[model samples]
Target chain A: MSVREEQSQPAPVEGGSSEEFETERASATPKGGEGCDGCDHRATKPRRKSRLPALNPPLETTQHWFIEAITHPGTIESGMRKAQKIVGRGRVVTDGPILDAVDRMRIYHYAYRARLVECLADDYPTIQYAMGADRFERLASDVIDALPSRKANLNGYGRVVIDYLQRGPGEDGGRVPNRRFYADLARLEWALVEAVHAAPVPALDLPALQAIPIEQWGDVRFTPSASLRILRFDYPVNRFLQHFREDKVPSIPRAKTTATAVYRQGFAVWRMDLDLNMVDLLDALLRGETLGAALAPLEDRLDASHVMAWFMAWVRSGFFATVR
Target chain B: MSARLGFPDLGIGIGLRTPHYRHILDERPKIGWFEILSENYMQTEGRPMMILDQIAERYPIVMHGVSMSIGSTDPLDTEYLRELVRLRDRVGARWVSDHLCWTGVHTHNSHDLLPMPLTEEALAHVADRVRAVQDLLGAPFILENPSTYVEFAGSTMPEWEFLSRLCENTGCGLLLDVNNVYVSSRNHGFHPHVYLDALPMDRVVQFHVAGHTDNGDHCVDTHIGPVIKPVWQLLRYAWKKGANASILLEWDAEIPSFDEVRADALRARRYLS
Candidate 1:
């Protein structure tokens, strides 16, 4: 099952009559205290009467209502209310012998939320660990509810988490702690996901660099790998991430401008912090600057040896696919 | 049992997941085939494609998707379909499969396989879409029965009837997931055998078997743990019903090691015998 199909369904009902119309309402009623796993809200309350009309709705109308009901940000009843408002229905779904209409619909409602949370959790495990499961789930739910997926694939869905956290406090019920720091952390994590999914390219090796005529180096424009990403942050979230990966929950540090490079080598994803001079040089080169022009801005800050060391490091890091 | 459309009955297999990637590459496990989630490898040309390039050379890979939204009223996504073709050609995949349900409507993808109302309107709509998809792929498009929770109040016929008619109308193939059938049957209070009996067994090109959570009132297709006795029995019954299709196991959550998943998948061999 893909992330979409991975939503764990609620437990099945026991044996019942196979007759289509046989309404075993006694056993079909949802048992009390039963909630979907990881879902805080359960449909234990008396469900409001169905608002869907008895007549067969058109396919478009049915889908619109169904999408609204399952994708509702709140409880299943609230989703139904939202669906009713959108499509003007009474209950369109049949209450089967095993589960009532509301209980049945709750499965999808909870599953949709659970599947997305799981996908984000996979990509942002450090954040999940930092916020604790409940808090992280709430934040993810808020992000998911706010930004419904527009693309067919979910690999890029977590892209919105960065903006969500940076949008400021009181926006998400204050569920997020250290909004700016978490935003940086999400940015770092999303970078890794992007790096892995990004196209892999061969780096200009030492021989390739040597092959480039030194006299022509001034005019050579370097081509960065498609997976290369240079990120600047107000927090040292990369260090925090390293600590978290080693099972050390370091306190979120104070804000400090940190420049980092995220790129992949073969199958391994690498993240390296950069100094101000290096950041300027790399940023210039990434903007299609030639060697001489890229270093001209940092000439005062970078000596001959400094340029040599940084160029060697960048070459070894597989950041540049070609320089010509 | 001959395949309906010459699709091979590759023996019991497991889904190609991330955790097992390293093991699959290092050991080159002796498995029948691997069913890949097509969307995972689509829209990206990174390590997944690199690894898939190597794996496809060694194994018979099948493409199972979740985002096609075949039953939606919205117009089909042409780019998505083109990418599917590109990936199928790139991977040399045995076949491409998605759910029989819709994902979302009006340009929004809920990402969850939402159920479709079993009505004449829906059946015809799906049939037309199936034809279009098949025409684009130039191959028989295979669809699996998604595990649905709610049945529409206005359903004019059962799901099996709808599937049978859809297959009859379009030259599509079926990836009969026994676990899904068992899960949906339990949820809807229908006998699993009754549901299987209604399907055109000859059209089934594959069978999906996996464990599900029995939540007392309804069975959720969690695809966790192992193949329970009943689900394997369902597979056995389907096999006995003459749907000689390939067998694939999907263990998405809490996935164990390749060897463990292989052992769990091999459990189907006994039932098939």
Candidate 2:
């Protein structure tokens, strides 16, 4: 079901005078109100009553109150109940009637939620396709409730989904089917997105690397491109993503260790699956290790010819920003 | 008619969207100008940015954003403004614009343009922010009237009055989105014509025309499909009132071919001419 349909309608609250409602709210604070309520202090602070003192102070006083109430990270009905206490009844008026005012607030509340969900859907298209529209939207809504967006950019909004899913639905008190696989998929997808938008760096051309003396090869350290990302997962997410991109409904493969590198080349993002040894070498190179040291650990396990081929392939793929 | 800010009317243009990127580059159709979503190309080194560089080289571009949050109580984001200035300078944008509403508070971004209370207090607050932004940008900052679903009970005046006073206070310009005016009017039961007539027509530097989804009693500003007759009528009304601002068609969802969207945008010329 759509989020709008899933949410229950807000019930109208009893109308009261501003002073009467303020006194009632202050009394209802549970005296101590024990320990923070875990709400963000910045978000839930009491409205500043002294900011504006007009004949109708309720409207001026309740401006931020209404915004905070509707965007309270809770159900719409609860938000309305909290907003009602701050503004009081019969004091709030709009160009439209009171009922329209209530409906308008509801629309804003739903629109905020809808936009967040839309961002998540765009950032994680593969996961959305796998989970289907309804299920993916439900998951997106739940993730949003747990971790509201703190950045001005929507592109940076859903970075926590992978970790959130890894926590195994503990918050929801339910098990998500194939939870591990889904988490891995989210990791790969998000990594690609980050790689695509990361800072651009000029790749070190083959001639530049060849110009270095043979004696300096041992001390030469390679700088990985800013758009390079090395991801390790327990599911074959790279293969799954390939099929998903091809518009085929492929079955989820059995659990298997998978290591992949995602990087941008010529303004296009590319993904490559690598063996365990190659993953280790790439990881070391990404950490600013010398070419000699990056290959030393894999020397005994792999043939010399294979190592040289891998090195040449990485350079051809434009993964190194510089070689010094 | 020249805008008070002296921004030239670049004639009818369309929003540069992703689906039409390949077609735009390959065909390079005859167009007046392009309005780019500032946030889309900011802080990115992706294909979108590359394509924008190519497009900006040939077309007149304007930067419109949603994250400026001008009405928020939070301190202005200097970093966002700096990047906006850089992007504007890089693209040689004619003007930079965002909505006259807050996107979030307390460092959180709702990504939706939330409504503002139409009061003297909000007017002063927003005017100050607009002046600061314009100073930082070293250009005239333009603001579009958002398609608001809710009207604040605390609003002491109509939206048109608040906008007019804001323009006067800040010396900023207006984008005058006619579809948004129509959408808000129907949602709040006001006359769209009165809303347009109340505006300072000379201050309008641009115009936005888009389609919306009409859901019985209320309408959602879904930039899909074609511009409706009522909204086109509103655009015509604004045009006759001497708002000779640059007109751009917005189609963000279910986008058709470039030819189709261009044709849709070209429809405005009939009313303007």
The best candidate in terms of TM-score? 1
How many angstroms is residue A34 displaced in model 1 relative to the true structure, after the best TM-score fit?
Answer: 12
The backbone clash count of each candidate, in order, is: 17, 0
lDDT of 1 by residue, B1-273 (tens): 246678877887888887788889899999999998888887778878889999999999999998898999999989899999999999899999999988889887777788999999999999999999999999899999988889887899999999999988998999999999998887787899999999889999888987777777677777777889999999989989998788998877666889999999998889988
Top-lDDT candidate index: 1
Contacts from the true interface found in each model, as a fraction, amount to 0.62, 0.33
Roughly what TM-score does model 2 have, to 2 decimal places? 0.87
lDDT of 2 at A15: 14
Quality of candidate 2 docking, DockQ: 0.22
- CA RMSD of each candidate after superposition: 10.4, 13.2
Q: Which 10 consecutive residues of model 2 chain A have the lowest summed lDDT? A: A20-29
DockQ winner among the candidates?
A: 1
CAPRI quality level assigned to candidate 2 from its DockQ score: incorrect
What does candidate 2's lDDT look like per residue over B157-248, in tens digits? 99999999998888889999999998888778789999998999999999999887766556667777899988888889998998888999
